[model samples]
Target: MKRVTGIGGIFIKARDTDALREWYSRHLGLDIADWGGVAFRWNDDNPGAVGTTVWSLFKADSAYFAPSDAPFMVNYRVADLHALLAALRDEGCNVIDRTDESEYGKFGWVVDPEGNKIELWQPPEGQ
Candidate 1:
C-alpha cells in the first residue's frame, strides 16, 4: 500500500497565538485567516489536480496533540485512511483508535516513536 502521499498540514503550539499569527502575517506574509491558519493551494503534475497544505497555530496548552505531549503535530495526507491505519496497527505502530470524519476529510491519529502525535488525513473527494 502506498503510504503518505504528502504533508497535509503543519501545526504548532504557541505561547501567544495571536501575536505569533500577526508576526507571521506581517513579516512572513502568511495570509493567516481568522481561524489562525492559511491554506496554500497547489497543483500536482497531473493536469487540473489541486490540493491544499495547511499551516496553523494552536494554543500552548491545547490538548489537540494529546497523548504525546508534543508542541507540534504534522498531518500527512494519505490515499486511504482506513487501510493505512489498519496496516499501521497490524505493524505494531501506536495507532490511535479514535477516528473522525467531516466535510474536510477523514482523520486518524498515530504516535511516532519519539512521542510526536501524527495526524493522518484523507481529503474529501476532489480536494
Candidate 2:
C-alpha cells in the first residue's frame, strides 16, 4: 500500500490580494501570479527533499502555539539565517533576529505584508 509523504502547499488569506502578492514578490523574491500563491524553489539534487515546498499557517489565537501569548503562523527551515535575515531587512521586510544558542537550533522571525508571523530556523550541524 502507498503512504503519504510530505506537505503540499500553504494557503493564506489576505485582505488585499494584490498587495500581498506584490509584497512577497518584492521582499521574499517569491514569484506569485495575479491569483496564484507563492511557490518556493528547493534543491533538485537533494533526494531527501522531494515534496511540495510550503508551510501552512493556522490561527495563533487557537491551540497552535499552546500557552504562548504570541502568534506563530509558520516555521520555515532556511539555509543561511543571517543572509536571509539581511535580505529580508534590505527588502524592507519586518524581520526579527533573535539568535540564541540552544539545543534545538538558531531561530528568527519575520512578518509578512499581511501581518502573518513567519519563523526562520537554521538547523545545527550533524542534525
Candidate 3:
C-alpha cells in the first residue's frame, strides 16, 4: 500500500494570523478566503484527474497541532487511512488514537519522531 500519496495541506501557526494572511494574499496573490486559507487546484497528467493542495494559517495559540509543540503541521493524503494507520502502528510509529469522519472524508493523526503532528486524510471517493 502507498504510505503517502501526496501532501494534502500545509498549516502554519502565526503570532498574527490576520497579518500573515494579508501578507500571503498581497504578496503571493493567493485568493485567501474569509476562512484564512486557499485551495490550489491542479490537473494531473492523467485526464480528468484534478487534485487540490490546501494552505492555511492559524492563530499562534491554536490547539490544532496540540501535543506536538510544532508551529506547523503537514497533512498527507493517503489511499487507505485505516490500513496505513495500522501499518504505522505496526512499524512502531506514534499514531494518535483519535479519528474523525465527516462529509469530507476519514481523518487520523500521528506524531513524528521530532514531535510534529502529521495529519492523514482519505478523501471521499471521487473527490
Candidate 4:
C-alpha cells in the first residue's frame, strides 16, 4: 500500500479568491488558469512523471474544506483511493464517508490529527 505518492494540489482559502489568485500570479509568477488555478505538469522534469500538481484558491466562505476550519487543504495523489480510504477507516482515521468520481477521477478525504482536511486523488487514466 503505497499511500501518498505525491501532492495533487495545494488549496488556500482567502477572503477574496480573485484577489488572491491575482497576487499569486503576479508575485509568484504562477500562470493561474481561468479555472482559477495552475496545473504544474510533471513530465517536464521527469520523463516518467505523470499527473500534475494543482494550485488553487478558494473563497474563505467556501465549504469545500469543511469539517475542519483550516485555511488550507492539501490534496495527495494516491494509487488506490478506495483501498487507502478503507485502510484509514480501519485504522480509526477520520476518513470522510463520501467519495466522488468524474472526468478528474476518484476523490476521497480524511482529517488529520490536527484537524486539517486532506484530499486524496486518483487521477484519470492517461493523466
Candidate 5:
C-alpha cells in the first residue's frame, strides 16, 4: 500500500489569520475566501479523474494542531486510512487514537517523531 499518495492540504497557523489571508490574496493571488482558504483544482488531463488541493490558514490559538507546538500541519492523501493508520501503529509511530468521518471523507491523525501532527484523509469516492 502506498503510504502517502499526495499532499491533500497545507495548513498554517498565523498570529492574525485575517492579515495573513489578505497578504496571500493580494500578494500571492490565492483568492482566499471568507473561510480563509482556497481549493486548487487538479488539472488532470485524464477523463473522469479530478481532485483538489486545499490551502488554509488557522488562528494561532487553534487547537486543530494540538499536542504539537508547531505552527503548521500537513494533510496527506491516503488510499486507505484504516490500513495505513494500522501500519503506522505497527511501525511504532504515535498514531492518534481518534478518527472522524463526514460527507467529506474519513479522517485520522498521527504525530511524527518531531511532534508535528499529521492529518491522513481518504477522500470520499470520486472526490
Candidate 6:
C-alpha cells in the first residue's frame, strides 16, 4: 500500500468569481492567480509536525463541507496570530482570536464575503 503526500489544491464555486477573488486578496492577502487558489507554505519540523494542508472553507449549508451539513473548517498556518487578526479586523473582517494552551496553539477565524469560514492558527513555538 502507498500513502498520500499532501493536498494539491482547493476549488470552490462562487456566484461572483471576480468579487470573491478581490475579497480574498484584500482581506487575507491571498494571491488568487488563475483560478482563485492561493498557495500556502506549511511547516515541517520534528516531533508531531503537521504537513502542508490545503483547506477550503464553504458555507455551512453548502455541500462542500460535509454530507451532514456542518460549518466548513479550514485551519491555516499563520506567522503571527495577533498581527493577522489585527490586519483582518482592520480590513473590516470579523476575526475571532482565542488562545488556550489546553487546546491547540493561538487560533482565529474569519469569514469571507461569500460567508466562508476561514480559520487561522499559529502553532506553538518550534511546532
For each candidate in turn, the TM-score is: 0.97, 0.45, 0.95, 0.93, 0.95, 0.45
Residue-by-residue lDDT tens digits, candidate 5, 1-127: 8878878999999999988998999898899867779988784543576777899999999999999999999999888999999999999999999999999899999999999999999988876
Clash-forming residue pairs, model 1: none
Instruction: Give the Cα error of residue 4 in candidate 3, in Å.
Output: 0.6
Best by lDDT: 1
Against the true structure, candidate 3 reaches a TM-score of 0.95
Q: Count the backbone clashes (under 3 Å) in each candidate.
A: 0, 0, 0, 0, 0, 0
TM-score of 4: 0.93
Residues 1-127, candidate 1: write the lDDT tens digits.
8889999999999999999999999999999988879999987754567898999999999999999788899999999999999999999999999999999999999999999999999999887
Q: TM-score of the candidate numbered 6?
A: 0.45
Show where candidate 6 strays beyond 4 Å.
Answer: 1-71, 97-103
For model 4, the superposed segments whose C-alpha errors exceed 4 Å read: 44-49
User: How much lDDT does each candidate structure score?
Assistant: 0.93, 0.56, 0.90, 0.91, 0.91, 0.55
Residue range 3-56, candidate 6, lDDT tens digits: 122333354545566776778889988766573466565555545554444434
Candidate 6 clashing pairs, residues 3+ apart or interchain: none
- Estimate, for each residue in 10-107, the C-alpha lDDT of model 2 and write its tens digit: 54545565676677779978866444665455545466543235533343345533323444345666666777788888889877645555776666
lDDT of 1 at 107: 99
Q: How accurate is candidate 2 locally (lDDT)?
A: 0.56
Candidate 2 segments exceeding 4 Å error: 1-72
lDDT of candidate 3 at residue 41, scale 0 to 100: 82
In the order shown, the candidates' Cα RMSDs to the true structure are 0.9, 13.0, 1.1, 1.7, 1.3, 13.0
